[model samples]
Target: MSRNTTTHDEFSDRTILVTGSSRGIGAATAKELAERGGDVVVNYRTSEDRAEAVVDSITDAGGEAIAVQADVRDPDAVDELVATAESAFGTIDVLVNNANISFSRTPFLEHPWDEFRDKLVGEIRAAYNCTQAVTPGMLEHEYGRIVYVSSEATRTVRPGFSSHVVAKSALNGLARSVATELASEGVVANVISPGPVRTEASADVLEQFEDQLIAETPMGDLAEPRDVARTVALFASDDASFVTGTRTPVNGGLLVE
Candidate 1:
């Protein structure tokens, strides 16, 4: 048993692979996991340089990490990503489906087919491919955690984020179904919906409404990436073994029903 029952000792001896970890929520989540003693495989699509910086930060902090490049949109690339992580860390015990291209400012009418393709299809493919890739190892160990980084957009229906809302909503449904399918095998899948987190990607999207958002949120400010990452860290732990097939809202009372 780990000195911290916050999760389990399996995490100490385990590796977690986080997609799109070069920045934003992904980077924050990877750091949080590493801080908790998990070896981290930081996956990035383009920012190998940024990825290395994140890895260096983790190492500097006495955590183990490596940067792995994979365009999550490509199935073959995701397969290679799984192989690389397993090779580097011996096994992948957790998968954080955090790679996403933001569509916050693109309204439904203004959304181009290409932009929609880039956001929805890319995320869906990434989640499906990566989950499939990491499952065998998880099953062999009879334990795994898959946290899909979703958004509060599904609940609030942010007008300009139609594409993102649709895509993230699909992820919720995908998680529920997969959770049911995998629950018997000791694999858990869930979603963490963070309301308006303040990260490089969100700073641009929330610029105009930042003040209004703060006023509306009960927490009186936008969520930080670490807020959501901490939730991911919890879900990735055995502490949440009984939790699955549900969305864990990390929002600051923005869309509470």
Candidate 2:
């Protein structure tokens, strides 16, 4: 993707931290926020090259960015990540919890309990750690945006995604609770649940249901990472100050309410 120059300025002089931003939706979000005038910290667990590429893209576009390495699942690492961002750009005004593990589909009955437990713990714990690390800084500044990238599987009730759905559902609940507790303090929390985004992580699953998904979706196409990133940008901007505790679906009408 080419560098986007659309400027919103809502994030001017602000700083953003996007976990797992080395690729896909997270990468797209990091670029989008940077384009809109936010200095960004690109956090990646294992993709240093990709993370630096993201930073280079933003900087090449006259935006400020830095690549930081952190495994979001580790509390100590998360704390260090937040500290690194603070040291680089003062404070993180937006936190996007987009890092997650990709696992092969398995029937709930046949799936190993250990695998299920690991998936849930990994997904939920990462978000918990990142949130805990950033909240204190946000509270001190009296301004913040917390966005959790979720999935439609939580509500669509699809098979073969038992562990994924449960973990995302828990993330939604966590966002809501955080929103309620932080709304009065100028910090807003929300979830952006995208249905079947086209990414390496979802390629296998999308291949299995491409025809059905396209037919069911009113828009007749799967979402690109940029599609979800746009919604995330909205939530991360100052324009969404009053919007909290809500899950905005970027599913192209696949499961509209």
**Residues 1-257, model 1: lDDT tens digits:** 11222423446887899999999999988888988889999999889999999999999988899999999889899889889888889779899999986554667888788988778887788899988899999899898899999988888886777888888988888889889999999999999999888888877668888899989989777788888888898899988999999898887787776
Worst 10 residues of 2 by lDDT: 1-10
Model 1 regions more than 4 Å off: 1-10
**TM of each candidate vs. truth:** 0.93, 0.96
Each candidate's number of clashing pairs is: 0, 0
Q: Candidate 2: what lDDT? A: 0.91
* Residue 78 alpha-carbon offset, candidate 1, angstroms: 0.9
lDDT of 2 by residue, 80-179 (tens): 9999999999888899999987665799999998899888989999999999999898999999999999998888987788999988999999999999
What C-alpha RMSD separates each model from the true structure? 3.7, 2.1
Residue range with the least summed lDDT across 10 consecutive positions in model 1: 1-10
